[model samples]
Target: MVKEVQKRKINKEEEIHISSSDSSSGDEKELMLKNPLKWWSLQGKRNPTETKRITLPSTIKLIYVTLAFVPRLALYGLVFALGQCCRAVAKLFCSSVGAPHLANKRILYISDYMPPQVHGIALRVSQYTKYLRSNGHEVHVYTCCVESRARTSFDHPTLPFVANPFNSGNQISYTAGIKLAWALGAESWDIVHVFYPNALGLFVLPACRWRGIASYCSHHVAMDDYANRYLQIPGSPLLQRIMFLLYNFLYDACYRWPASYWGDVNASMTQTFVKRHLPLAAKYSHVATIGSGVDTQRFQRRIPTNPDLLWLWCDSQCASEREALCKRIGAPTNAIIWLMVQRLAPEKDIHIALDALASLAQQRKKMNKELDVWLVIAGDGPAREGLEKRAEQLFTNDKNAPGRVTFLGAVPNARLPSLYRAANVFLTCSRSETFGLTVTEALACGACVALPRCPVFDELYGHVLPESWRYDADDKCGGHLALIDAAQAAASIEASAWLEANPIDASWSAAAQDLDRQYDQAVKRGKTKYTSLRSYVQKRLIHLGRASLLLVAFYFVLSYYWRNIYCAAQCRIFLPSLPKPVRALCILTFIIALEWCHC
Candidate 1:
C-alpha cells in the first residue's frame, strides 16, 4: 500500500514539473517571435541540442515582411511619380511654347574682354561666339576698345566703345555701359549673353530687361576667392567675417542681383562652380553648366621619328603647320618631360611644381639612376620673374647641370597642340581652377596628365584618369613623390597604351550643342511667367534684411572689442610716446570718422 502511494505522488509531481516547463517554453517562443533580431543574434551561442527550427505564426511573418519593404516601396513610388510629373510638365510646356521654332537665335554677347586679353574668360567668350556663329546663329559681340595690335580677325563686327577713366583693369570698362545700352535699344536681340558680370554686364542686363529681351550670364571666376587671396588681409575671425560680408555685398549688387533680375539663365563652366559659387543666381535663374571645349582633332599625338626634322618644321613660318617644339629645344629623346602650361600666377601654384621637380632631381641622383628628367613651364605672368629666379637657384648647379628646367614663355594657341604632344606628361598644380582647359587639352593630345588633388581636378579626371596620375598637392612630400612616380610611368611602355584607351570627349561642337539646349530651356522659362511685383518686393525685403543683419553684427563686434583694439594699438611697442588721453581721443575720432563714412 505504501509503495503504491509513493508511485502516485511521484507521478503527480512529474506531471506538475512537465506542465511548468511547457509553459516556460511557450513564453520563450513568443519572445523569439516578437524579437527575431535578438533571437537570431543569440542563436549561435545555443547548444546543438537546444537548436530547433523556429516556426513563426503566419500573421507575424507577414507583418515582419511588410515592415521591411513598405517604406522603401513608398519612397521609390514617390520618386517615380515626381519624375513622371516633371517630364509631363516639361513636355507640355515645350509643346505649348513651340520651342523648336526658336532653334536658331540672334545672340548679342556682352563681354568685358575678348581675344588678345590672353585670359581664360576671353578665350571662352571667343570660342563660344565663334561656335555659335558657325551653328547658323547670328552672334554679335560688344566690348571695350582695345589697342589695334590687340585685335584679331574674329573681332570683325565686334563693336568697341570708349571706357571710363577710372577702369580698374583692361577687361573692366565702366563707360561701355552707355554704348551697350544704346546698342541694345537700337537692335533686336533674341538673347543677350553676358560673359562676365563686370561694369559692362551690369548695364547690358538692365537694358535687356527694359527691352523685354531674354538674357543670361556666365559665372567665370569666384570674386570672393580672388579678393581673399589678393587683398592680403589677416586671417582673423573678425577680419574674415568682415571680408565675407563685403564680398557678398559686392557679388550680390554687381553680379547676382543683376543676373537674377534681368537674366533668364546663369551659366557656369563647371558643375562644381555652379554649386559652390552661384547659389544665389541659381535660386533665381535657370543655372546651367556649359563647359569650355578643346579642339581634340588638332591636339593629337605626333611622335616624330627625327627630332631635327620636327625642329625644322617648327622654324617654318607656316601658321597652320603643326610641329613638336620640345624636340627643337634639344630635350633628350630618352628623357621624361613633365610639361606645365599655365599662367605663372601665385594662385596657379607654379612654385609647387618647381619644388617637386627639385625634389625629383635629388631623388634620382640619390638612387644612382639616369637623371633623364626635365620640367618645361610654358606660360608667363606677374610671378614669372620670381619663379625664374627661384628656378635658377634650385636647378642650376655644377653637379646636376642646367637646362633641367626650361621656360617656353607664352606659347600661341596655334602651337599649343604640338607643345602638348611633345611632352610625355602634363602637370597642373593650380590651387583653384574653375575648368582646367590646359589640362583637358593635354589629355586630348594623348599626354598622361598628373594633377593636384583638388575638387576641380577630381571632377575632371578622378573617374577617367588612373589613381597613379593624381597626387595630394596639400602634402609637400606626397606631391614630390607623386611627380616622381608620374615621370616613371610616363617613361614606361604602358603610358601610350593607357592614353589611347582613355580618350576624353572635349570638342567645341559638343559644348555648343549643350549650350543650344540650355538656351531653349532659358527661353521657355522666361516666356512662361514673368516674376510678380510681390516677388520683387519680397526679394528687396530679403536683401534689406541681410544688409541690416550684417550692419548690426558689425556694430556689435566694434562696440564689444573697441577697447581691446584701442589698447592694443596704444601699446608700448607701437605708440609708447603718445599720451593715453590722446590715444583715447584718437580712437574716438576714428570711430566718428568711420560713422561719418558710413553715413
Candidate 2:
C-alpha cells in the first residue's frame, strides 16, 4: 500500500517539456552559423529565415508590435554595453584567475515551474540538473509548491476565450517570492539559473546581484503572443475585434512586468533569435540535450515494459510492440498512429491538427483512398478538455475522419519512447514551438514528421525534412492535408537516410559545458561594479526607466479596467445631491475596488 501511494505521488509530479543550436562549432562553421541569414545555405536553400508575425488588436498594435520591441532593443543595448565593460574589467582584475573549474560548482535554480509539473521548463531544468550532478556539480532547485494536475480542471471552453487578465496562460505557480527570497539568501551558491522568468525567476536577478553570484535568465518562450493566441474570440468578426481590444489591455499589463527580459545574458532556446536580433544571446543561449545521446540508447531506455525487447527495441521489436501499444492506448491495432506530444494549450494550436486530420479523411474518401490514421495525443493541459470536445465535434460533424482521437493523458516520461516507437507518423499543428523535444524524440524512434511552415521549424528541419514535409500554418484550409501527406511520404523514405539528414544533436552535457564556461567567467570576474561613470549613469537611468515602466504598466492595467468596468456596468453614480468632485472620487474608488476584487 505504501509503495502504491509513493508511486501515485511520483506520478503526480512528472510532466512533459523545451531548444536547438544553429549549427556546428568548428571555427568556420561557427562563423557561418552565427549569421543566421546564411542558414538557408545549410538547408539546401538560398533564402534567409524570416520571423512570423502574430496579429494583435489595432488599438495597441502600434505600441505592442512597434513600440513593444523597443524595450527588448534597449535591453540588448544595456547587455552589450555591460558585457563590454565587464569583459575589460575581468581581464584587468582577474588576468591570472586561471582556468575555470567546470566541476564541483554550487548551483541554484530558481523557477516557479519545476518537475513534476509536466512543463517544458520543468523538464529542461530536470534534465540539465541531472547532467550537472553527474558531472560533480552540487545543485539546488528553488521553486514554489508544485500543484497536482488532478486538483486542476482543464475543461474550460476555448471558443469564447477564458484566460488570465494578464494572459500568461494557465498552470503557473504564482506564490513564490518570499520562499525564493529566503532560499537565495540562505545558499552561498556559485551560479543561479532561472528557468521561468515571468515569476520568481525574475527575483533571482537582484538576489544574485546582491549575493555576487553569476546569474542566467533563460528565454524559453516568446510569451507576448500568448494573449492573442489564447484569448482569441473566433465566433464572429465583431467578437474578433473585441478580442483584439481585450488583448491590448492584457499586453499592457504583461509587457514591462517581466524582469527576466532585463538580464545581462539572456539564454535563448534557438540560435536563430541570437542570429537575427540579439547577437549577444549566443553566449548564454544553449541547446538542451536529447534523450540519452545515441538514437539506439533512447529506444533502449523504457519503464515497466517488456524486458526482452528493452535493449533492441528500436530495431525490429519496435514493430512487434506496436500492436500492444495500440491496445494499451485504446487505438486500433491496424491504425496508423499519428502521435502529438505536447501540453494541450491554445498556443499549441492543436485544433489545427484536428481540422487537418478531418480534411485528410474527407480528401481520402473523395479519392477512394484507404488510410486509417489515429491522432494519439500524449499530454494534458488547461486546453485538453476543450481540445477533446473539438476532436469529438470534428469526428461527429465531419463523419469522414480516418480514425478517432486517442488521448493518452500525460504519458510518463519513461514510456514516451514506446509511444514514439509505435507511432507511424508524428504530427504537430503547433507553429509556436522553439524546438520541440518531441520532434527530436520522434525522429530518434525513426518516425516521420509533418511540420508547420514556421521559421523555427523551417530552419531546424528545412534541410533535413523534404519540401513536401512543410505545411502552411497561416493557410489553414488545405495546409493540414498537405502536412498529413508529407508525413505519409516521410514514412515511405529510408529511415537511415532520414535520421542522417536531421540536425538532431542536443547533448545535455554540452548545455552543462556552456553553463560551466559562464560560471567560470563569472567567478573570475567576481562582483566588480562598472568602472565607467558614464556607463554607471546610463545604468541608473535605465534602471529608473524600468521602474517607471513597471509603474506605467500597472497604471495602464488599472485605467483600462476602470474604463471597461464603468462602461460595461453602465454605472449612473452621478448623485445630484452630492458635490461633483466627491461623486467622481467615489466612483473612481469603486472602480479601483472592483478591479482589485476581480484580480
Candidate 3:
C-alpha cells in the first residue's frame, strides 16, 4: 500500500510538471509571434527534464542546432531590449524639455546659385543665410563660382550646363562631387541644408551618409513644369523625348533620391507645394511648410517726389542711365508708370502684361480719356529683343507713341525698395511661380500688386490683397480689364490706406525661427537612428561570438570520440592493415560524413 501511494504521488507530480511546461511553451510561442525578439527568454526558462529527454544522434547535431537557432534568438532579444530602452529614454527627455533644445547649430548650405543671380530662389537663400548667421548660428555656403559676388564664399568647381533653354541666364553647373566631399570632410558641420537639389547638393547627400551627418533639402522649383514648357529641342521629336526623359531622370536622382536616403528634414516654401509634391511627408519623418521671408523694414513705403511723373525703376544708376534707357525704349515721363519687375522670359508671360497695356491705351483713347500710360519692363533675359520689337510694332501707327514703353534691362537689388516706392503699381503675369518674392516686397513697400489669378498667387495673396488687385489670367479681355482697374485703384488713397492697415507680416525673423525648429527635430531623429544602428551591430557581434564558442566546443568533443573509435577500429577491425596516416585520414572523413548527416 505504501509503494502504491508513492507511485501515485510521483505520477501526480509528473502530470503537474508536464501541464506547467506545456502552458509555458504555449505562452512563449504567442509572445514570439507578437515579437520575435522575445524568443531568447524561452531558452533560459525551458524545462531541464525536457532537454534531457530529447535525444540526438551526436554532439555535432546539438552544436549545429545551438549555432543556427540560439544566436538568432539572443540577437533578436538584445535588439528589441535596446530599442525599448532608447524609446523610454527619449520619452523621458522630451517630457523634461517640453520642446527640443535648439542653439548654436553649425549649418552648411549647398546651392547651385546665390546672388548676383537675379532669381527668387537666390534671394531667398541669401536672406535665410543672413538671418541664420545673425541668430548666433555658424552658417557656411557651398555653391558654384559662376557669377557670385559674396566676399566670404566657397565655390565648388563645376561643369557648364544649360538649365533652361529659353533663358541664357538660367545656365548653371554640375559640381564635382569628389571635391565637395573633401571640402565637407574638412569642416565640422552639424547640419547640411541644401537650397535646391542641383548637382552640388545631390553629390553631398551620400557623403553626408558616410560621415553620419544630418541633411535637409528645400524644394524651390517645379522642375517638371519647367522642363515640359522650356526644354524644347525644335525640329526633332525623338531628341525632345530623349531630353525630357533625361531631365526627369536627373530630377529624380537629384531631388527624390537624396530626400529619401539622407534627408532628416524636407521643406517646401508653401503648404500647397508640401501637400502636392511631398504627400509622403509623414512617412519621411520630418517635413515643414516655411515660406520665403522679405525684409519688410527695408522694403517700406517711401513717398514719391512727383505724383504726375510716372517713375519706372529698372537697372539704372543715375539720370543719364535712365535717360539712355528711356531713349532706347521710348518711355514717356508724364504718364502713369505701370512697372513690371521680372525676368523677360516666356514663362513670365510678359506679353500678357504688354497686351494689357496696349488694350488699356486703346480703351482710354476711345472713351475720349487721356491715353497717358507708359509701360516699363525691368530686368533682362533672352526674350528682351523680341519683346522690344513687339512693343515697337504695337506703338508705331500712333503719332504720339514715342514714350509708350521702355525696357530697364536689369535692376540692382539695393534700388528695388526705392523703385517700389516710386511706382504707382507693381505688375506680374507669371504662370508658374513657386513663391512670388518680388510681389511680397512690392506689397510691403506700399505698392498695390496687380497679379494674375493663379493658384500660387491666390494662395499667397488672395485673402490679404484687395479684390481689385487679383485678375483672371485665363480670360483675355476680363484679365486685362481687371489689370487696368487694379492700376487705377492703386493710384487711390483708399488702396494705400488699406495696405497700411493690413501690413505684410512675412518677415525673415519668423522664417528663421521656423527653420531653427526644423533643424532641432532633424538632429533628434538622426541621433535616434544612429543609436539604434550601433546597438544592433554590437548585439549581433556578441551573438556571433557566442555561436562561435559552441562550434569550437563541438569540434573538440567530436575529435575526442573519433580518436577513441579510430584506435578501436585500427586494432581490431577493417582499418587494422592500413598505414597509420592513411587510416587516420579515412576515419576523419567518416566522422565528417556522420556529422553532416546528423546536422
Candidate 4:
C-alpha cells in the first residue's frame, strides 16, 4: 500500500515534468520524457543527422616544446658539480644512517602518488610498503600529501604535494624536487622505487645515479592512449598531426628517460608495448615483471548480510550497519546489485554499462531468470553530471520510481570492500588501464567481474578467470552488445561459484620477495657500494643515449651558429667584440662547459 502511494507520487511528478518541459499532449509527454538521451538528441544535446560533439571546454593547445636547449649546458655543469660536492660531503660526514644487513635491505618507496590522492598507484605503493615490512625489510614511503586528515592508513613524514595537470589534478604531489634532493643527499637507501615518472623523476633519477642508489620504476601511465586523448584541437586533424612530435617528446620524457629498470617479465608484452606505444623502441629494454599484487586480508571482512546468516560469517553489528546502508542508498531488498566503483571519467566508458543495464531490464521481463538488476556507481568526476542524467533516462522504466541506478558520490577507499562484497557483480568498461587494480580488489572481495577487452586485462586475468569473463566491444555502438554478454557470463560465474573454487593469490609478501630477489642480484653486481665521479656522469648519459646526443648537438649548434648570442662582449664586431684570439679562446672555454652534460 505504501509502495503504491509512493508510485502515485512519482507518477504525479513525472506528469508535471512531462507537461512543463516537453509541451506535448498528455499521451506523448509520458513517452518523450522516458528516453532522456533520445530527448537530448531532439533538444540538440546531440544531433544524429549532423555530427556534433558534446559541449566541451575550449581545446587548449598542448604541444610540447623545447626552448634554449643548448644554452643550459653551463647550468647543467654547475648543478652536476654541486651535486658531486654534496654527495662527497654526505658520504664523508653523514655516515649512512640505516645500514643494510645481509638479505634484508633498507628500501625507500618514492612516488608522486600515495594515499589521500586515492588512485591505483597510491594503493600499490601502500600495499608494497606494508608487505615489504612484513617481509622483514625496513621500508619507508616518501610522497606528496594531498590532504591533512591525518592518514592512519600509512605512516610517513609531511610537508606537501604532487600535481597532475594531465589527470586534471586527480594525482597530486608537487614542489618536492628540492625536498627529495635534500633527502637523497642526507640519507641512504638500498633501493628507491618510483611509481610514476612525473616531473620529479626528471632529475631525481639522476640524483639516484649520483648517490650510487639503485633506482627502479613501476610503469603505470599508458601515454600512447593518453596522448591522443588530451593533445588535440577538436575538428583539426592537421594540427593534431603536427602534435605527434610533442607526443613523441613526452613519451620519451615520461617512459624512456626516467628509470634504469622497471618491473616486467613478459618479452612478448614488451614487444607489443614498443610496437604500439613507443615512438622508437630503445635497443636495450629491461624485462623482469615482478607483477603487481593485492592485499587479500584487507578485503576478507564480511559485509553486512542477513540477520539469519550473521552468525555464519559476520556479527550482528555488520547486519545492522549493512541494513542502514541499504536503507540509506534505497537499495531494493531483493534486487541483484551490479556495482561499479571508479572515477566517472569519459575514458571509463560508463555509458556502455548503462546501455547494458537497459538491455538487462528488458530481458529480465521476458526471460525465465527474472533478474532484479540494479547498478550502483560509486565515484565522482567531471563527467558525473552528464552520466547521472543519462543513467536516470536509462532506468526511467524502473518500477521503483526514484530509479534503479544510485550515484554514491566519491566513496572512501576504507568503505570500498563492503561495497565490493555487497555487490553481486563488479562491472567496468575501461579499456585504457595499464593495470586494472579495482578488478583485482573486487575479486579479492569475492565479487565476480565483467571487464572489457583490453590487452592488460587479458595478460593479467586471462589465466586467472574463465573464458567468458572478458568480452570485446565495438566503438560504433559502444559496449551495449558485448557488455550484455559479459553480464550473462557474470551470472554464470555466480551460479558456478568459481570464486569459491579458486582463491586469488596476490599476496604482498610474494611481491616483496620478488623485489628482494632483484635487489640481491643488483647488489651482487656491485651496485651503489660507492658513488664515484666518472661512473655517476657516465651511467646517466649512456643510459639515455638520445638525450645525451640531443644535449651534445644542442650545445654544438649554439656554439657554431649562435656564438655571438653567448659571447656578445667577448667577440669584436669591428672592435664592438673581442679580438679574434680572445674571442676564439672564450668560445673554446664555452664549448668546454658543455662537456659534463653530454656523453
Q: What TM-score, computed on C-alpha atoms, does each candidate reach?
A: 0.63, 0.59, 0.65, 0.67
lDDT per residue for candidate 4 within 482-591, as digits (tens), equals: 78777667856463388866867676667767767876665443353454555577556545765655789888876674565446544354334566666666655665
Give RMSD (Å) of candidate 4 vs. truth.
14.5
Q: List the residue pairs that clash in candidate 3.
A: 315-410, 315-411
Candidate rank order under TM-score: 4, 3, 1, 2
The local distance difference test score of model 4 is 0.60
Q: What stretches of model 3 exceed 4 Å from their correct place?
A: 1-103, 146-149, 153-167, 183-187, 235-239, 278-282, 302-334, 476-478, 535-599
Q: Which parts of model 1 are misplaced by more than 4 Å?
A: 1-103, 145-170, 233-248, 302-330, 476-478, 531-599
- Tens-digit per-residue lDDT, 293-346, candidate 2: 323345432332567665332445665679787776555677777789997666
Q: How accurate is candidate 1 locally (lDDT)?
A: 0.63
Each candidate's number of clashing pairs is 0, 6, 2, 14
- 3 or 4, which is superior by lDDT? 3
Every candidate's lDDT: 0.63, 0.56, 0.64, 0.60
Candidate 4 has its poorest 10 consecutive residues by lDDT at 1-10
Error of model 4, residue 356, in angstroms = 0.9
Candidate 2: residue 93 Cα off by (Å): 25
Q: Estimate candidate 1's RMSD in Å.
A: 31.2
Stretches of candidate 4 exceeding 4 Å from the true structure = 1-80, 86-104, 134-140, 146-163, 169-176, 260-285, 301-326, 364-371, 397-402, 475-477, 492-496, 526-599
Q: Write the residue-wise lDDT of candidate 3 on 365-409 in tens digits.
A: 788775677777778765665677677667655544444777777
Q: 2 or 3, which is superior by lDDT?
A: 3
